[model samples]
Target: MSIEQRDQLVYVDNGAGDEPLSTREMNPLFSSVLEARLARRQVLKGSAGAAALGFFGLGLAGCNSDSDNDDAGDAPAADLLGFSAVAVSTADEIVVPEGYSYQVIIPWGTPILGSFPSFSVNNTGNDQAEQVGSHHDGMHFYPINDSSEDGLLVLNHEYVEPRLMHASAQGVSLSSGATPPLVGGLRPADEVRKEMNAHGVSVVRIVKGANNQWSVQPDSMNRRITALTPMEIHGPVRGSDFVKTLYSPNGTMTRGTLNNCGNGYTPWGTYMAAEENWAGYFTNKGDNPREHSRYGVPSGTGRWAWELADNGADEYIRFDASIKAADATGDYRNEPVCFGWMVEIDPFDPSSNPKKRTSMGRFGHEGVVFAPAEEGKPVVCYSGDDSRFEYIYKFVTAANYNAATANGSMLDEGILYVAKFNDDGTGEWMPLVYGENGLIEANGFTSQADVLVNTRLAADFMGATPMDRPEWGAVDPANGDVYFTLTNNTRRNDSNLNEANPRAANNHGHIIRWKEDGEQAATTFTWDIFLFAGDAGESGVENNKGSDPNGNDLTAENILSSPDGLWIDPDSRVWIQMDSGWDDPFGNCAMLVADPTTGDLKRFLVGPIDQEITGITMTPDQKTLFINVQHPGEGTSGDQFAGGSYSSTWPDNTPSTRPPRSATVVVWKNDGGVVGS
Candidate 1:
């Protein structure tokens, strides 16, 4: 595509122009960053003679800690960055340092397009194609250059869990207040359509105010890409016969992306969204030998038997694979081949058709982490397979890095490899290339298309090392070492443990790191377990590293469980997030800040009751922290939802009081001072 054409696709300038959706607006931090940058550029443009003077850069800003004004004795101040911790136990309040405060910028479903009316409780509408998706998940705030007054916030809506998202609240029979069984694995047709429309991502513009806050840009630059959105296929696998279905004959197009989890923004500035847990959305006959053998759908294991639903909508009925059609080439029994890959989105332009770059090698992609792209060097990425006993993967693009092409187009060509951890604390990057690694030569494999279609089998054939439920991964900008969270695996134990995964029944979970050999993407790397989290006292001295001097072991002070969200700040400070397992003794989920080099980890903030600390992002200044509180009180049902019966009364405890909604909160220190100092 030409640069102008690409720019139009990424910049999103037409359609509704600009207008704020709500009469009442709150200043958001996200928009402030953009405004500040814009003002700086405006000054330079308006006064070139004065602005052409020598540049004077500012020194490092630090997070300051609050100290008491005592004449006696006080502790020394720590040298943290421009960040502080503030506790927000409720939604109606934005608690921060004495000077800093936050406001609700975007909640669920405020109309993005003109067709959909404002969202209402239990309101059913067919204008889903033009609506903001339900349930916001992972997101990023991109300041358009360092000058534009506005920027885009690319957000992912992971999935729409029925009861919490739909009109009928998961199809419960109101008379008896009973939920129908989630059996035969079939969902109602309308429910399926709603879900399909709500599964993808949204790119909306945001602006800032002089007071340093952000707000959403109403109708301008607002676009929603749903499961029904027409998308193109790119890479070697595009146009392959395996992905063909009744919907797309050439296999060059597909509908909506599902289960988009954590994401990565290219150095060139576009968004890379990974599709996860999408396989279970399709249906196939449990008895068809040819179908079962071809895709390995495990007989009777189809989760969404949509073909059998009572609804006559073809979109809802497509998931079924049980019926035998005279022409195998025309029906959707083979639809499973189309999903589970990384989809790229350009936030600047809303009209661009998102592309699922197939050469990245599809699997249960939790997230894709890119190494800083360098000229003439391989563009590398690290990804995890989010299943128990699954493997970790890496992809090195074939193209040389060109700073000009950083605009999210570099992902088109790549050599995908799977990891194999050895018993000697070392690992190898086994190539899963079409004709190499015995993948094509192995049993039950026919062509390169087959290998990509069933990537798990290809990895298994290459002897890829199995890992404990690997979730999200982060590449250390300072050291190029990759860190991934192995959430927990009940089936693993001492006897079944191996070099890469050493623990069994790993309840508390651990973070694993590996360095590519000589910092080369194609070579193998050294590996080790960074830390083991568990109930400090019960976990034993061996896992704890050293005794706490007091001799007492199992203490809450030393305990942490199921480490989930993880981020490495610019300065290399590691922030760890924990998701309290269902059986966790910890009362709430929390985010911990730690110095891995020194093994000095401290609890920073805890989440509300019954929620997981998932999405976490910080500003370039590191002055504020934006965190997501997902699925609070998930166990409660609509029929039993009420004031006291509800699991959590977060953000809001009044109004209908049906249930708690997942929300994102910004926390910072008061006094306009740096936090953690």
Candidate 2:
């Protein structure tokens, strides 16, 4: 497709644009299992149904409790969601519960490092490298000496919108997420650099002061790891021949991280940034290998056309992986293989190089959630591939986690497994090892490095159950139950329906929770549907899907769709954030709180027009909460943008002048109580 034609497809109803769908034809579908389970549910509705529900741990009351705790005869904890739920809104500002207030901090282009250059559309690429990046997604707050009032705030910058970011595109009539007109068939080098600088992670020191206000505090630890930052490659795929490129001939290093969507922190006090939707950053017109083809690398041009920079520098030209020589080392054919892995960064150590842990496997990694570490057990974590019909994954370290010596190296040697959900409310984790389960040399997987490089193909071959777009994952600290958000999937039809994913043409998504049979590293588990997202007006088996195991449905107090960002607090309250298109009965994307024990849910906060509510974290005391507002004026048309009109101008609220910016919002209660309460 021509560059102009591609630009026209950039802005969709959904802000981020749809992820490339999985094209594996032979993978097993979870729909049949779901159909069988639903049939069984219809036939057995009395005590037999109750017994079946208990077998799957589907009892709504106290289902998240441990088996030992259930037998202890302990009383249930008091309700934690005490605040009145907010109403749905389309206002160009934040709306929270009645007892709470919020402050906007560390917006895009806000300087947090050297020279402290102020924010401006005309800021140079160098200035962008020193300032906060754009479109904040997943985040984590690291406490300083375990203090609730002081800490390091680290977040991911998913991607950039050129029309809103560059001053040169002010009157160029560009839609949201569309690039400006090409200059002499090439993009301006500085514009490309600035966009690249805006697509990574940021670490800033924030302090809570009097009046419960939060502000950025410049410290030595404050840093910006952008697309131009240098990083190291570790694990089995480090020095493989598939990753040898002109930039890193030794295949042990790569430059920059892209499309950092979801994030996680390790037990050893380091941050991990997930590389999601990164395949579109490169164009591979020649020699399309399975690694690039399975990930949907464009054959014509990249999403942003960084490879067509006017200066034709090595860094920019390398984005076009058209083979230029006989071997991979002499060209950039292997450049696209370097991305799509979780990058580990130490927020406290400013000079440390971020390491990409290859043992975790590579795909459209929405995020990684690590289970609480045990003394003499392996460190276990779960991740979901955020693509239609993709599979969820788990990684168990080969070495047991030792608090005294735990570090990123533990991620270097691990077993990566894919999930398979069955019709009997049970699931298993199948190993994606190179030589196991038909992943041998005859089947095209030559080594462990090859399996890691083509993780999606390996998972498909293992007969893993395909799911809707799985986004964020959360683990309940009190009961060790794992929850995953299956964001909306409009492509699902009757042919692909399953027990876990029962809805066809699922516009609004659902959340699924599972409990491991024994430990976090165990392969077998029991699964159940926690909640289904929808509007109050929609009902029946196909539209909104049925309610949870407990009869919960759409109410004024609880309506949501596309559950993307998720977290479980110490009090066992499930926090859900939405990222969906504009729709009725649900005015805009929002955040909600749910009591898993009782299946009671309520809306907590609603965001501005055309914005996504994502990336949540909190202080050590749980009295303060932090969430992100991304792409506030996302769906504005080209004419609207050129006429100095936008859908939203949030955090600034100026009169049709300042473009809306993605920013972090800090929320606290008026009575100094817990945030949700």
Candidate 3:
């Protein structure tokens, strides 16, 4: 890209000139590393009776119905289907408890298209279509009815690494920093296209056989959707002025989905890929500073220098939000508004255009999760904002969830609400409806489209509670309680901490959960801290109950920090995943299994150095578990060539044969038995 344009590039950043465009601030550390453990660890130093343990009844541990054991400690863990908790491992490998076997099922650059060629160090623009995208995240398995060994695997590719990509046959790379280096005053059109094609979702058929072996059925129902794929806009905001782009003046359609992070599956058998951190991708050179700033779009340039492409077609110009047109219909100024919604995709039918469900309000959506479904009741979907001091939101579908009629239709129309946690242990789900709040034309909201498009503003105006950094959420299928990971907030000061978030300058994150008052669809609820993830020795700061309500202090054995990805297994086991910039006492980012009832937590698996273990999903039988390890070599500042020469070369096992590629690892029991049992 041109010097001026390259200066705005955030993706290839090696951290030299300007801070990456994602943050509203200019601090280089404001990225993921901004929320490091602060020096305020003295808060919980001394003195007190057991603080109000969440939900009370610590003795209920033994009676935890999820486990066959009636006793908490003395109870046979086998009844809980428990394996020996794996000790934290610092070795450069996947570490799981004994009797469990893990295999790398799919890695970045795995070919999935039958006609397309295999990945190479000399990859070209179109090669990504046949390859697995980088940074694999949230995923799920859809069983082919009556088949136990076959299913579909759907996942998201959040972003790309330029240094690792766009290299010649040699491992030498083109970029040195976080942003890609410019070539002849502009990013090569080929490189830009390849990266763009890498930022969507992938679906491939997977089959398991003897020895629990699994591989992708490349010629099967495999498909790839990238940043330029055609998609239709649906729900209340469809065809609204808010989404009027040059490509879709009618506002019913858009091109591509980017930053596909956490994902979900609708009862109707469709996939939901949530768009996150999308604002940094677009920039405005136009007069509409209001709309651009409202979405955190930088004024000068975008994170990617796609505008400087050799092929300056409409596709290239769309990345430049600078005003060049007379109105929104004349250009792509309104494109940013089209993203940040939960996109519904039909995995079974690749012919369908993924629809952006506008009813699910947008704003750095982490992911969406549904409550257990019933034949005739309003369906509820929960999501977190995934920004510091943002909000948690839910969509209460206007239509009841039904298997026969519910073919991804409930997500089309819903009442969107942001959560507000009261100090009294009660929380209210505030409605973000246009008429109910001050969301009227007088307040700049002319339509429901306005309320949904500018959802963050509406939530702020309606007095919704701002959380630390809501990431992923899960609803317990057994009792209907919802859980969310606050995921730490360095920006939070003492003033922001209320009963819900009780730490000043909160660094170590906490898990908060609640039960809806009457039914799964209730708007009001009772909430509490299920657990506080802290340092190895952090004391009774969590309502004085230590980390567990059973009055036990958190240790390296069962401790974790910066909780991110989360999911409740079929057996009512809460799986906690960690994400951080620094190595912790318990080693690198790892996964922990928790008994929600007894507050029993154990480390199940530990990832290699510098990789974040994310995106958890299990088979219908609950015997197989899947998780993603993203950016294995991310922690290093040098050497992107051969793996393990510098930073981390993880699951690749060997240093030279393969690059450290983000991939999905499948964990299952060695013998034919229930996993975790």
Query: Looking at model 1, how many pairs of residues clash?
Result: 33
Model 2, 1-677: lDDT tens per residue? 11122222232321235364244574646434454655545643411112234445444223644565656577775777899999998788899999899999999999999999998888988999999999999999999999999999999999988888788888777866578888898999999999999989999999999898888998999999998899999999999998899988999989999999889999999999999988888888987888888987778768788999999998999999999998988889998899999999999999999999999998999999999999989999999998878889999999998999999999999899999987667899999998888999999999999999999999988889889888999999887889999987777777787777767778778888888888899998878777778776554434653343344446777878778999999888899998877457688889999887666788999999888999999998999999999888877778988888887878788735568999999999999899886
Query: Candidate 1 vs candidate 3: which has greater lDDT?
Result: 3
Per-residue lDDT of model 3, residues 269-317, tens digit only: 7889989878777777656544456556766556667777777778777
In candidate 1, which residue ranges exceed 4 Å CA deviation? 1-104, 125-131, 147-150, 170-188, 210-213, 286-311, 407-409, 538-558, 582-584, 637-639, 642-645, 655-658, 671-677
Per-residue alpha-carbon lDDT of model 1 for 1-677, expressed as tens digits? 11112112111211110110111111111112223323432543421111111111110011111222355366543343233443323222333333455544455555566565665555443555456565555667676665333567677777654455455543352211122244454456665566567668877776656555666667556888887778888876787767676778778887778778777777777788878766555555544433234323334433333344555566655565554565435776556667778888887778799998887777777778888777878789888877667778888877778887655456767677888876545679987777775766547667666666667777877777778768778876766767788776655655556645555466556777666777558568767555566654433434322111111222454345667777777756677777653334454677766554434455566666556677666655555566666656544544554223555655566426344556666655455443333
By lDDT, the candidates rank as 2, 3, 1
lDDT of each: 0.59, 0.84, 0.74
- For candidate 1, the per-residue lDDT at 169 reads 48
Model 2 spans with C-alpha error above 4 angstroms: 1-18, 26-62, 66-76, 538-541, 545-549, 655-657
CA RMSD per model (angstroms): 15.3, 3.4, 5.7
Clashing pairs counted in every model: 33, 5, 24
Q: Against the hidden true structure, what lDDT does model 1 obtain?
A: 0.59
Q: Using TM-score as the measure, which candidate wins?
A: 2
